[model samples]
Target chain A: MAKDTMIEELLDAWEETYKKGQLTFWVFLALKESNKCMEEIKEFVERASDGTMTCEEQSLYRNLRKFQNLDIVAYDSRKVSKGPDRKYYYLTTTGEELFKRFVERNIMIFTKESIINLLTQ
Target chain B: MRVFTQRLGQFAISALIFTVAFRYALDLSVGMKSFPAALVCSIVYFGLMFFAGWYYGSKDAVENEIHDIGFRFHFITYVLCIALGYASYFIGWNTEPLRSLNIGAMSWGIGLALHFVFFLFAQKNAIRGYVKEEIFQ
Candidate 1:
């Protein structure tokens, strides 16, 4: 039981370190899939990351603004029936290319059979 | 609403500080003919400006939708400082042209030029948005 607790603690620490850098990747991935409103983007990130990652709406808005400034993302304001206009965001061409290069260089390697087998073992 | 008022109050305070310090520094160096004392005043002016910028600029970056706050703040502040420098000279607050310009305007103009270059490169990356019609058509 102590060994299990020890392992759990170690995994928790590892995730804490790893998760900090992963939000940007997850945010980009969510936008890449489809143009989504703020709430939708948050849902996508939480659902896709299997609840391991969560983000506040304020943080997401800040990130979106930064990405917009960098030309990595853009949005269109669509009118909603109930209230004010809602901004639906999507990855820009630059962002898509950036994500492609990032995945090819970093994430694709983990998909190799050798790496996959080693991870499973 | 609360945040907006807080930001407005901060802006008001910053403006007041700049106006008072800028005038005092100009008067000290130009009117008093105390170059060394003016230099100290100028340093204080710069320190206050830089602290206000770096502190609030970083916060503004994440909190506000505006991304070019740093560049804009530096540009506007320096421009106003230089204009005030020239105005002081024209108004006979300073009898010396070179000393007046050298004390504040010229130095800040150079800094503004460098900042402009940074803004150019940073703004260059800002491309056109994703237009649905363009893609569909």
Candidate 2:
């Protein structure tokens, strides 16, 4: 029974790891270069993806919040002239390192080698 | 529950495929006997799985950054253990067959436990990094 519990625990952990939408490399890439708010990230994604990719504000905000929870993303609200303050998101050092590794095998925005260099700094 | 079950099934199927390819690679490399070969194989295998998880896991609308962080945490811990094993072997401290298994196991357990708690509690906090102290302004 103890062994079974351990196994179950392992599965639960894996489930947590395997949860969907946890690897939005494009979103990370957008923020890695500079801190950005939701609109900025969305615009960057669209521009970078050339209209092929778009992340809705709601999804984007939720992703940013989750990343913040992991300490991979950091944010500070900025006041604008016309509206409510917006949260600008950027990759924390930890997030940048993780992004570098994630870029090692996958090509999301830049060449693998170039991205590793850019993200490492 | 349906979503969880569906996710479990998806993960199982993908994991099965990855295992098949990974097994073939190992068989071709060192026949699973040599320690270094096994070690390298495990690293590459897990690394590939990590990428695969990230790739597929990002499909849904809801994001789970904590989950991604957990994956990286375990992967890094595993890599560190492997590096330590290699370093110890080269330094003549021990053989290449993971002489200090307890170190790896203990370190990984500790790191993973800490990672679990950090992410879990981080989600519980009502506030995030953003603040308005008016000092910066």
Best by lDDT: 1
The digit string of per-residue lDDT tens for model 2 on A16-114 reads 655334327678888886888887788888888677566677867776766676588898988989889978888999989988987775545665687
Which window of ten consecutive residues has the lowest lDDT sum in model 1 chain B? B128-137
Model 2 segments more than 4 A misplaced: A1-23, A108-121, B1-137
Task: Kindly provide the TM-score of model 1 when superposed on the true structure, using C-alpha atoms.
Answer: 0.65
Off by over 4 Å in 1: B1-55, B64-75, B92-98, B107-137
lDDT of each: 0.71, 0.61
TM-scores of the candidates, chain A only: 0.93, 0.67
lDDT of 1 by residue, B25-130 (tens): 6676766778888778777877887777667666654465343425666665665656666665676664347575786666777778888787666555433221
Task: Report per-candidate DockQ.
Answer: 0.09, 0.09
